[model samples]
Every structure is written in C-alpha cells, then in structure tokens.
Target: MNRRQMTFIILVNALVSLLIVLLVTWIVELRRPDPEELAALYTPAPAVLLAPTVTVPVETLPVVGGDAQATPDTGTTQAEGDETVYVVQAGDSLLGVAARFGVTIDDLVQTNNLANPDFVFSGQRLIIPATGQTASPNATTQPAAPGEPQIVAVESAGNLADEAVLIVNESDNPASLAGWRLEREGGPTYTFGNVQLFAGSSIRVYSTSGEDNTIALYWGQLDPVWRAGAVVRLLDGDGVEMMRQVIP
Candidate 1:
C-alpha cells in the first residue's frame, strides 16, 4: 500500500479512539449521583415515642385550688339516694367508715387527704372524690372538737367493673375485701386521672354495710398494687375493720 494511504487510515483510527474516550468520560459524569439528591435520600428524620399512663395518689398529689382545710361535716345528714353520702360518727377510721358505704380504704384516704393517715379523728368531714374512688394528703391539720364524728363517710356502691369496683350490699351484714388495685387496672381509689396504679404502694379497703364484719376493722396492704390477687401485709388505720354494717 502507498505511504499516504496508510497514513490516512492511521489518522482515522486515532480520531475514533479520541471520540471513544470522550464518550466514556461523559457517561461516567452523568451516572454519578448528585450531592443534593444524595443528601435528600440519606437525611436523618426525627422520631416520636408514646408516654406511659400515670396515676397520682391523692396523698402524693399537691393541692392546686379550692378549700385547703379538711373536708367538714356541716352537721347535715346524707339522705338516701344522695350523690354524696355522709358518715357521721366520732373517732372512726377511714377504712371502717368507708366499709359502711361499700367503698375502699384508699378512696377515703385520697378523698380526705389525710396527712398522718394514722391520725384521723372525730368531726373531720371528707369529700368523696369519686364513686369508683381514688385517693389524700400530708398537710398540717387542726385538732378536732370533742364528740365530733371521727370520719365523715362516703359510699362506693357499684359493681367490680374490672376496675377494682366496690361491691356493697346496702343491707348485707358481712363481706370480705382486699386493698390496692393493680396499677394497670387503675382503680378509682389510687388513680386520680388516667394514671396507672403503682405496685408495692400502700392501699386501703372498706367493707359493705352489714356485709363486712369479718375483722371488725380496717385492713391495709403495704405493697400489692402489682397484682390484685396477691395478699400482703395488713394494718388497721385507727381501725381498719367493720364492727357492723348500719343502714343509712
């Protein structure tokens, strides 16, 4: 072949090689991910978590507003079918008084905000916070007058709706009882709002009128809110039992 023809062929090959290299470089640049797009794909996002429910014991809760004085018995009677029932008697323990109304011990303590707890006396009136009942307090209280009812009683006559309900027999003469609802169950006595009942905490129970004379006194559980069926150490608040059920 002539030298000129060979040179022409070589030149054509060199140009083709250059074009191929440029095409490959362009394809590589296009295939790389954009920095902005990469950031959007890998950016971190915020997360959210749910809070557990909590129930504040009446005693532990701080008083916000209203009459800070002890709940008073205005020398009035709790007539039949009244929304708030009254228990008139001097020197009655919270548990004993509540039993007559088929309530739980914690209900009375929480409703009344008994500070000493061991020291409730006559003429001290209490507000029944809730029928289902959640409980009380540790502030200073003045001494009571002589012959005043020890505890102003309230009632908790209802079914045990899986909520540690107080079962009362408006006239039944004997009944049994347990203290402290499971925290998860959230009984009215230990649960003020929607908080869960805590385990291993002190709780009280009341008997049904005419239905709970078994011990003739109050019974307390030092720590049993974890599970309802388990029995725990018991004590008498002033007196934690029922002497007899009286019709109101």
Candidate 2:
C-alpha cells in the first residue's frame, strides 16, 4: 500500500477509540446515587420508651372546731347506747355542759350518777348521751348521805349459785336501803325495794333470782352479772356513788 493511505487509516482508528471511552464514562456517571437520597434510605428511626403505673393510699381525718375544750365525741361507743365522754374543766357545771351539747341537766346526772347533782370537781370524767334521748329520774332515789352504806365484799364470778355482794352499814344511825343501787360498769344493776339496814349490820346480795329477805337479797338475773377483776359500784338512794368493790 502507499504511505499516505497508511497514515489516514491510523488516524481513523485513534478517533474511534476516543469516542468509545467517552461513552463508557457517561454511563458510569448516570448510575451513581445522590448523597441526600442515600441518607434518607439508610438512616435508622428513633426509639420510643414507655413507663410503668403505680398506686397510692389515702387516710381519713377528724374535723376540729374553734374551741379546743368543746371537741365532739364521735369516736366512743357505750353498752347502754352511743355516748360521748367529756372532761370537766375548772368552771364547768352540769347545767352548762348540758347546754353546750344541747342536752338536759337530768341526762348528765343520770349518765354520771351524780349524787349531789350540784357538785362536780375539775378533771372529772363525765358521760354525755347523744342528742334526743331523755334520762328517766328515779323519784324514790334520795340524796346521798356522807357515809352510811359500805361495800365489804364482791363475788362476781359464780354460776348462779354462789355469786354474792356483801354490804355493811358502819354509820351511827340506821339507813334505809330502799332505792339503793348495786351496779356494774356495763352490766347488771340491782335496786332495793323496801328494806332498812341497821347500824353496824351487814347484808348479802345474790345474783340469782329468789326471795329477798332482811339479810339476803335477790338480783333476779339469769346471765352473768359481772366478771372477775371487775368493779361493783354502790350508789345511795339519791343515785350518788358511795363505794366501789372489786371482785377477787
């Protein structure tokens, strides 16, 4: 072949190689992904956490008024009925205390078994009944004399046969046993009918029901009247407390 023809063929081959390289580079650029799009696809989502449940307890409280001395008795319960215990202040009287709680003076006398009704000492405990209850007065009950009936013995625990309460009169003059009462704190009460106790003499009060005589009296009770280690109170004719005897 001629020299000019050989040079033209070499130039055509070089141009063809350059065009093929450019086409391959353009295809590689088009296949590559954007940086923002890669971050949205590969990034992980945030985690969520939850908390636990809990419980709480509540308590109750009593309501108080202005006067501290005049707190209501809403927490005490008695065997006779629902009652409130009150403390007597320095200048407190049965009538005034009754008025404060909207009760009658007779209620205070009957509840506390006041012998003189007019005499009350400071720091003494008194029971005041709830509203709307009338205390019945014993007409035969008399005012208590200073010292007449004495409690000598108290036998509270016997099975209806041997339970007895012994009482004596150590006074100089004779005293009537009529309307006198022998009672337990939350239990039985016995009232004398028509009997006279001579000076320096003694009598026995039985628990079971039977005939009442001069020396022996029947309480007319079937159930147990009192328990051991209990106190028996002796009240005079006027419902005044005279003595207390504890069972052995």
Candidate 3:
C-alpha cells in the first residue's frame, strides 16, 4: 500500500474505535439509575405514627321502682329545721351527692356514721346536717348558659409542645372558665382561670409553655402530659363532671 493510503486507513480505524467507545459509554449510562432515583429505590419508607383518640367514660344509673322503663332517682331532700333527709337513689354515689350539695364526702360519712362511703344504696335514707345551705352548686349554676363547653379535638401523640386539646363553647352567652378544671385519669388537674369565651367560640389548651390567651391556654408542662388510653374529664366549678373524653 502507498503511504497516503496507509495514513488514511489508520485515521479510519481510529475514528471507528472512538465512535465505538462513545456508544458503549452512552449505553452504560442509560442503564444506570441516577443518584436520586437509586436512593428512592433502596431507601426504606418512613415510619408513620398515629395519633390517639378520645372517648367518654361509661356510667350506669340504677333501675328504680321495679319498672324497666322508670329512670333511677336520686331523691332531693328539703331542709327541715336543722337536718335534711336524703334518699339514696340509683347512681347516687357518695362523692356525687356530696359534690352536688356542696358538701364533702367525709362530712356525709361522719354525720351518717357510715363505715364505708360506698355503703349507701338505692332507697337508703341519709340524714344531711344542714348549715343553712339550701342551694345546690350544681343546680343553681351550670357550665354555660346555653350549653356546656365541649372538647372538640385533641392531639396527644406528639411532643409536649405539640400536645393540645381543642374546646368549643356552643353557648348563647359568654362562658366563664373560672374555677373550671381539666383532669386526667392518672394525671394532674389543670384548672381554668378567669378566662371567658364568647358564644360559638373555641380555644386550644396546650401542654407546653405558652401565655394564656383568649383562644389558647397552656399547661406549662415540661414533659409530655397526654398519652394513649387516657381519660380527660371536664369539671365545672362545683366539681361535677360536665364531659369526658377517652384516649385510645
């Protein structure tokens, strides 16, 4: 072969080799996944934690008059001179009756000389020592005018700062939160101050540090206060439970 022909042949061979190398590199790159896509394929899915739920506690009243349809009655007694006679009714617990009449359970037991507080039963008569107290705190005053405040929602599965309970006032007038309390089954009691809410209003109470505002209240707890399978009780000024919520 001539020198020019040999040079031309070498150039063609070199060009072909370069083209083949580029084609191979392109194919390899096409088959391989990008860094983000590779991470998505190999990385595990994030764990999902669910929030807790709330339900009301169960309470059963007594069946009275031997009638299946008759409702149980906790007989109300009027003051006669120095003492009042109270007839125990179904669901007429000592703690409940005392709270209703603004008296302590201890007072009821001591005056009646009862061995146990739970000894009282349906149709049993109890003598209440009168101190000129005629009005019942639970009867005279209520949670709110139109209706009591309700627990609308709650977030109990997060950190202390994120834990919260939402309450709404469905009353006609402004509802005063004075002397109101929020109690947990196995936790501390959170008392409400002089805060008031208007009709059709809502407020959020947190477990962490925050100033008490019109729409929010803080428990100022350092650790997480709410947990799973807990019951939240809302009590009025008379210490009577207005509502209850159970966590799941």
**Candidate topping TM-score:** 3
| Candidates in descending TM-score order | 3, 2, 1
lDDT of 3 by residue, 1-248 (tens): 99999999999999999999999999999998899978777967799999888888999987776667964545766656656778888766775566445554556787889998766788987877564122233232323333778664455434686677666776567788789898776788899999788876667788899888887899988887666656677888999888776654
Lowest lDDT block of 10, candidate 2: 132-141
lDDT of 1 by residue, 1-248 (tens): 99999999999999999999999999999999999999989957778778998997676666657658556555446544564645546745555566545456666667677676556656666555435432111112121223211222222323222222222222213222333121222221221112122221122233222222322222232332323222112111233322211212
Off by over 4 Å in 2: 1-146
Among the numbered candidates, top lDDT falls to: 3
- Of candidate 1, the 10-residue stretch with the lowest lDDT total is 134-143
> What's the TM-score of every candidate structure?
0.25, 0.40, 0.41
Output the better candidate (2/3) by TM-score. Answer: 3
lDDT of 3: 0.71
Please give the TM-score that candidate 3 achieves against the real structure.
0.41
| Candidate 1 residue runs with Cα over 4 Å from true position | 1-88, 133-248
Compose the digit string of candidate 2's lDDT tens values, residues 1-248. Answer: 89999999999999999999999998988899988899989968787767767767677555466454654534223534555777778776665566445445556788788998778887777887664321122112232345577654444355677667766665668888899899986677899888788865667788988897888898888876766656678887888887765554
RMSD of each: 19.7, 18.6, 23.7
